[model samples]
Target: MTTITTRTVEYPADNLTMIGYLALPAGAERRPAVLIGPEGTGLSDVERRRAEALAELGYVALAFDLHGGRYLEEPEEMLARCMPLLADPDRMRGIGHAALDVLRAEPRADPDRTAAIGYGTGGAVALELGRDGVDLHAIATVNALTTGRPGEAARIRCPVWAGVGSEDPIMPPAQRVAFTEEMQAAGVDWRLVVYGGALHAFHHPSVDHTVRPGVGYHPRHAQRAWRDVVALLAECLPVTD
Candidate 1:
């Protein structure tokens, strides 16, 4: 296993003091970086572990915060907060850019070689950053096939990849069509992968807290999605020794 270091980082975003997790590979040589966005429930151990995994792969990774430092386990509370945030593109960009700044500021991160990967609400933020014309080398999202304003997608300059569960009610077929149409119209290099026999948040593990119907875990699909995401990164943002 590659040696890596992890730490907590604090930054300002969405009118709150966001607490994020930073993971860096061993050595002082600068390396490609990735911005990790967590689901609407906020930053948790899941995202932190992902960052560490990326670090082990030799990329600096930062798991950004969503709701300050709170993790909303209640579905009602999560929806109430995420619904409004999702409706506002500018707000989402603010959060994404703030986290990007933190990632790029890291001494070991090569700011010019960066990508953003997010889940759920975080995925929406990642899409917003692309739509806002952030210079991302690659963008990948799971369970957040959100369509942006009118022609904003044309501003995206990098390849985009999205993963979704076949039975995700929140991101139904029509929504997926709309998202793909937007990407196609913008002439962006994009692809979508639908995991068979899965539902919303299939990539996430089953939680102890109550979750909405149609939301459950699929261990196999989750691993498959992670492999796909890693493949996307390898293609768009390869790490060098």
Candidate 2:
């Protein structure tokens, strides 16, 4: 196994102090970087572990914060915060760019070779970054099949890949179609993967709470989604030794 290091990173965004996690590989050489966004519940061990795993794969990864270090356990609270943020592209871009700044500041991060992968609300942020023309190598999101404002997706210059549970109520078929249509209209190099028999947040194993209807974990699908994401990164943002 490759050696990796992790540390807490605190930055300002949305007029709040955002605490994030940064993971780096063993060597000092600059490498492809990844901006990891957490779900609406905020940054947790799930995202931190993901950053570490990416570091092990030779990429500098930063799991940036979403809610000023607050983790929302209640479904209502999470929805209240995320819904508005999703509707406001400028705010989402601000949050994403703040963390992108942190990631680029790292000595081991190759700014030009960066990608963004996120989950849920975090995924939406990743999409917003691409829409804002951040010059990402790739943009990948899970359980965040949401459409952007009209004509904004044209600014996305990289390959976009999204995965969602077929049964996800939040991202139902209509929403998926809208998202795909937006991407298609923009002429983006995009792909969407639907995991059958899975629901919203299927990649999250520890979220056992019945926070809402049609949301649960599917362990097998979770693994498959991760493998797919890794493949997308390899194709679009390969890291060299």
Candidate 3:
């Protein structure tokens, strides 16, 4: 008997009433709340399930829609809405913090054990949240690039993990290599895994864009990545075992 519900949150910063779904595990006390960010395509049904899965694993998971319910059909259109936030990372941090606030404020969610995960451009937003010096327990990202902004890598105060597709052109391997190096140099506790034969949208199963070369699906990678995320949250979130 999972106590899950969905709601629309009106963030005061941008006056954006972002629709968010929350899933609460049954009988859980002082549970961790994970703020999940939608992909570049926005909050698809698949993302919802992913959040629910996290919720099933003894967490209060809240998946937020970054696009205000107007999902675009093309990458360009998605970029239009995502770019402005990217240009001024402060605003991006606002969105993540706002969503996180909404999650912690939930009756079933314990603010003490909070974390975040994101996909695609949304991953960038999650990173911004981490860089904003918020007190987060853990942060996980998929298919996201390193922002490389000065003073950012030094701001993370929690365990971090990232999943990348080996052949993801958008998040090229070389760049990931550099990102790892930076994380190492910063002495940040981070884990990065590259799925050997996967592409950019490996975690997104509802896509048929795999027909295009160097872009597609990896059911195996997706499953593994999803499992890894759950494991990370369980391991990182505040819990007394």
Candidate 4:
């Protein structure tokens, strides 16, 4: 059976207990570490599976709780609970730093080889962490709503790979364009994968919301984006088996 450990961690900034699940790769000795932030729905089974999948790729994965293990089926409720964290960027900044600290503290994780990947609100949060000068080696985002606007992108220090569906309504193309221009001006090594035939949260099969036709999860595109993410992390972290 695949080996994994489930536990809870405290975010010292807020002292809120966040339930975390850590999965290890085989024959681990300070493996490359990845911090996976949950979507707006909080820490779901799919999120855990995603973390485990990351571990299978020869990296240590930590699945973080976005909403403290609570699941909200209604969009309105999720918005109500998530707005506070988003409104105060400082909170995300602190949480992201804490997550990185947790990864670095892991005996089986390589501090030098660290990357963070997130979906939805978490994606924006991860990007914000990079913007705040957190020294994260790499970043992967899936359909993030915010992108630090035009001026803030210059502050990002790490390589960022943003994966967004062409049909993502929440994050408009204009915003993506502005974000791209900002990255160029800042000289940040960043790339974007605009999936031609997918909707928001394409990698997350558990989510049922779709805006329109021809805008759903294209498995082929999702798999390719994931491969690109892994390859990018390997290039940045250079973890050796």
Per-prediction TM-score to the true structure, in the order listed? 0.98, 0.97, 0.90, 0.87
- Model 3 poorest ten-residue lDDT run: 206-215
**Which of candidates 1 and 4 is the stronger one according to TM-score?**
1
Candidate 2: worst 10 consecutive residues by lDDT?
205-214
Better of 2 and 3 by lDDT: 2
| Candidate order, lDDT descending | 1, 2, 3, 4
Instruction: Write one digit per residue (lDDT tens) for candidate 4, span 6-125.
Output: 555555434566667777787747788888887776777776887788777778888776665566667778879787877777788777777778878888888877788888777877
Better of 1 and 3 by lDDT: 1
**Regarding TM-score, does 1 or 2 come out ahead?**
1
By TM-score, the better pick of 2 and 4 is 2
Q: Highest TM-score: which candidate?
A: 1
Question: What is candidate 2's lDDT per residue for 65-112, written digit by digit as tens?
Answer: 989999888888888998899899999999999999999999999988
Predicted structure 1: clash tally: 0
RMSD of every prediction: 1.1, 1.2, 2.3, 2.8
Q: Of the candidates numbered 3 and 4, which has the greater TM-score value?
A: 3
Candidate 2 clash total? 0
Position 23, candidate 1: lDDT: 98
Q: Which residue runs of candidate 4 sit more than 4 Å off their true CA positions? A: 1-15, 149-152, 207-216
lDDT of 1: 0.95
What does candidate 4 score on TM?
Answer: 0.87
